[model samples]
Target: MSSAPAFRKFHLMRQRWSQLLFAHWPIDPALLRPYLPARLELDLFEGQAWLGVVPFTMSHIRPLGLPAVPGLNRLHELNVRTYARLDGVPGVWFLSLDATQPLGVWAARTLFHLPYLHARISLTQTGDTLRATAERTHRGAAPATFVASWTPGDVLPPAQPGSLQHFLTERYILYTAGANLQQAVRGTALWRGRLFHAPWALRQAMLTEWDSTLVESHGLPTPTGPPLLYAADALDVWVQELRRI
Candidate 1:
């Protein structure tokens, strides 16, 4: 019998969900280097996957005239010194949405990686949910769309690194479900500004354990083709455990 896939503990580093849709564009590698952390690391596979992380840090403060409430600054922000990585394949790019800004445009043109990026993000409003969608063009010809909706939780628990769904959900909720998977993920300008979404308000609740090397997925085929399919049906299904890793 085969062993089940173990999910790693998740880090509740972010909360708000911001989705992006990219249509046709090219990215430059050199342009990305400057934005990455000095001590960053990367592992690349031809036109397929690239995994790496750069250091990151961000602060929040209202502009001179903006309101100074506890959480009200999603207009202008800044992301500093953050590290991120990705494992992108044909349709798998649909699963990664980690950063606030759409940094994938530069990667596609330069690395020929995750040629297209797309997705949507849901926010919390008076305990209800508010969603926003964004993206950029990559493939130079193809069009793609990514979407997700989430409810707001007052307390986003730290994901157990070994909990694939938990960790991944936290990751997507915090990082990769909106942009180019192959692109380097970074802190967004929103962090330095406001906390318009639940994801942004939960950044300080991170607790990391040992780095995990386990990856698992619950993927489904698409009606359009193999390149376009739904990963799962439940948008609100709380991750239980991976049937396989």
Candidate 2:
């Protein structure tokens, strides 16, 4: 498999992600195939598919060369996502993205054509443990909520290719679909967004506390058993503009 690709072209935005909790669960491929766009394929690792629910804080977010706005500079976000590939390019395909800030949600939806929803979200840190909560409040959308706490453990060596950790966290591109249009010739054209970031400084994570219905809210079966967990301290990211693929 290919490692993360570099973006030599101009990036449209920049942001910092911190205190991230990567929680994932294995799922049957059949459960997700029905929801994915016709042009995208569900990515798998060793014949198993996975779903992820990640919660974190984003800061210093602004378009390239622009000063970060006061209220929009930072916020909490939670996303329900899975892996996918389009024409041989691996990327993240989000089922839903919930953010505490409205403007951020609007920009993600309008500018990137992703499923961005407004939610009530909060994060607190105490010593080595972090607690996060998110409740989707977007009108006319299915309700989704997540509450969990995690503590970082020993730092792990970088994930080798083909490992589950690498499959779950090494993604750098994102694919999004625009609103469905019955008259459109290509019903499910996909858009690709590229991101540049340093390799993740990952550590084993202990799930100190948890409760969530975020996955089931998407009409998929509730994930059973504990989720695979990993934590990252922080990373600076540059995002490129979305383009048709």
Candidate 3:
């Protein structure tokens, strides 16, 4: 019998507003330093349903978007988003705005339609490698499942012909129930290729539409393809290696 609760929650609060505003910021340590949260928590879920919470904060006047939202002209803002998982799947997310300000509770209940947060995770360990299966569900319906396979290896190494890229994972796929969605974005990326690549500014501008084409081909409705979900920051190189688990 499974005794674990069904959901994990993380509450993100903001101290200083982040300057970057555009969505889908690549996972970069330096660029994300300004917005990195100070503290957060993860709670255990139990029973027919499960709940978890994490608390963190952000800054005002983020660099990437519209002007900061001001309420009572306070220097800091406090809020929390709860995650709830049911049936071992991603369930719902509820956001509580203005925890520190007056009427914050009323605003959270009336203005936004925040739902309970949830997610289902399964892990398998094979020798030195681990495989994680993450599923997202809405109501009783499952949205998508992301399977990640990881193992300890060098960050950057030379690429050989017909070899897999080491900087990225073996593969990332989406699934629904037991059926493969077939709507998966698969590609081989080598960050450290000895190729003439543009600087960050030029690369960002030129590769803006790369995601759109890549994801759309896989039956996804992404106006822009999903951004590169890098695991580490400022990783400018790729390696090629595959070891048995």
Candidate 4:
């Protein structure tokens, strides 16, 4: 895996993430190019591209000087994403980020310059299993839904560099091109946000149930093969303010 940027002395946001499920499907690079800005190249491995559907929950979300409000602090999130590079700086490029909180959605979109949408989502834990259900409910946005139940298995060591797992899950920066994904096709403002977090304490996750329409919502075909799945329990994170790229 790669290292993060120099740690920021101050961060605009602090949040804790839990029950993260990372599901990736390999796809043709050409299929994703049109969704990103022409200036950004698809970050590929072994001449292949990947699409990821990640489901997780966020807690204690707060801006630098503020207290976390009770009604707006906790939410479930699901994102459709891919990897990309701008001048060789690799980072995540999201197609859509669906969250259960409307105010959080608006705040993210307005302040971060990222695509964030409202959705109906729930994530529950029973014993060692996690069950999640999500449906995009944003008005006029592309419809999507996800259902999954998985149990974390044996813990794995940190991913080594050049490995598929490393390439897919070890990202620390994110690139955003526009307020929405559709606006990026023709070119728009491009920004980068740096995140600082320790290496994921990853584990193999056994899927007992899985179904999703996130990729198809973007006009991509359903992945023909089963997704590669990995899980992480919790991590504290810091997000720097977005900077023009």
Candidate 5:
């Protein structure tokens, strides 16, 4: 894959993502196929698919040229995602995103057509360790909770094109659908949002603690063994408006 794509035209939102943890596990392609829309294909590495559960803190969220709103500017977010490709462009396909701010959830669902849910979440730092927790509170939605603690380690070199680290962390586009696969096949619109950020400052991470059912809540099996872990300091991002594919 080429380096992270750039989108300098215009952006609708700006935010800082900090103290992030990327935890991923391999899964069978057949199991994840049914969850994706017809217009997008499951992106795989060496014929194997993977699922990721990311927990991070969002700060300085605001519309372009506007100041950050007091209560909406900061929040904790956790997301369950998988890799996808549409017309040869790789992007993230989110199954569910749970955030602490209800307004943020509503805006994401309505404006971006992403599957966003309201949740109770918190993040704390103790010395060199970071702790995160999230519980999905959306009424009638599948119950999910995540609790994890990690310590950042030495910084690593940048991920190369063919590496798994690059595949999982370097994605710059996100694909979402307003309808299910059946509707997509019937000509429903699929949306793709582009994001621009500096190359990830990756670091080795030690997952000191983890107990999560976020993936299983979506009807998939709980991940087995330890996950592939990585951490990053922070990055300022610019998100362009969602476009129809």
Candidate 6:
């Protein structure tokens, strides 16, 4: 819905995202600038910048037209992200992505140039409540940990075109810089990947416990005050090829 993909249909993989919690906090745009590639413009909503800590489950992951491998298809994923734009197109810019699967991390880093790090993570759900935990265990990487629990409440319709919820959750493109990847690889300037998914089935959510070092891991200050929380129902996704942009 960010105006980039037209259901392009030529995807690299198919995956499902479920039991997701989107936790967001407003931040000073200046504080996030140093961490972004110069080529990207930090995207803002009414002159404000936001950072999100998202915990979700990835399952049924497999290459296009291939069957999912039994052991490797499911993973626990958590990411810290901010918004950005490139060539007038808006998208997400990841600060870090921690995953439970080692092979999945390697494939994402090498193929998509994302900042995918290895971590110990788990997720559990019962009725309308979910609990999640994560700790970065990748060798030589900055240590970051998160623990949280929440209950989904009051199903909401898809966000309208101009609403804050739409700005915060409906991103369909993502940008990555090879040099900024976790392992310090160099040379590629910038890359963009487009994805296609249906409108999110959302629910208002309440977080009983919210604590993380994900934002601080990038040397940014811990944001104060309660965060904006939303829970999304499962959506199947189509990830297209990552191309230098």
Candidate number achieving the greatest lDDT relative to the actual structure: 4
Give the per-residue lDDT digits (tens) of candidate 1, residues 1-245: 02212321321112221321111111233433443323232212232222221111122322323443453323211111112343331111222222233433343223332222322222222333323232323243233333323333343344454432232222321222213322333432111111122121121111111121111111211212111101111111112211110
Give the worst 10-residue stretch by lDDT in candidate 6: 179-188
Error of 6 at 36 (Å): 0.8
CA shift at 32, candidate 4, in angstroms?
A: 1.0
Question: Which candidate number maximizes TM-score?
Answer: 4
Give candidate 3's error at residue 90 in angstroms: 28
Candidate 3 ranges beyond 4 A from true positions: 1-116, 140-142, 156-245
For 136-177, candidate 4 gives per-residue lDDT tens digits of 999999899999999999999889999998999999999997
Q: Give the per-residue Cα lDDT of candidate 6 at 42.
A: 95
Better of 1 and 4 by TM-score: 4
Candidate 2 at 62: error in angstroms? Answer: 1.4
Question: Each model's TM-score?
Answer: 0.27, 0.93, 0.22, 0.95, 0.93, 0.93
lDDT of all the models against the reference? Answer: 0.24, 0.85, 0.24, 0.89, 0.87, 0.87
For model 1, the stretches where C-alpha displacement exceeds 4 angstroms are 1-104, 107-127, 139-141, 146-149, 154-156, 165-220, 223-245
Number of clashing pairs per prediction, in order: 57, 0, 43, 1, 0, 0
* Model 2 spans > 4 angstroms off: 1-9, 179-186
Which candidate would rank higher by lDDT, 2 or 3?
2
What residue pairs are clashing in model 5? none
lDDT tens digits, residues 1-245, model 2?
Answer: 12323652467888889989999999999998876887889999988899999999999898867889999899999988999997788899888888999888888888788788889999999999999988889987789888999999999999888888888999899988863212111465778898888778899999978888888877899899999999997888889778987
- lDDT tens per residue, model 6, 141-166: 78999999999988998799778899
Per-residue CA lDDT of candidate 3, range 1-245, in tens? 11211211111121232111111312222322221122211112222111111111232321112344666322222222222222332222222122233333333223322222233434444774444443333234224444444343333334332332221222111111111111111212101101111111111111111211211222333333343221211111111211111
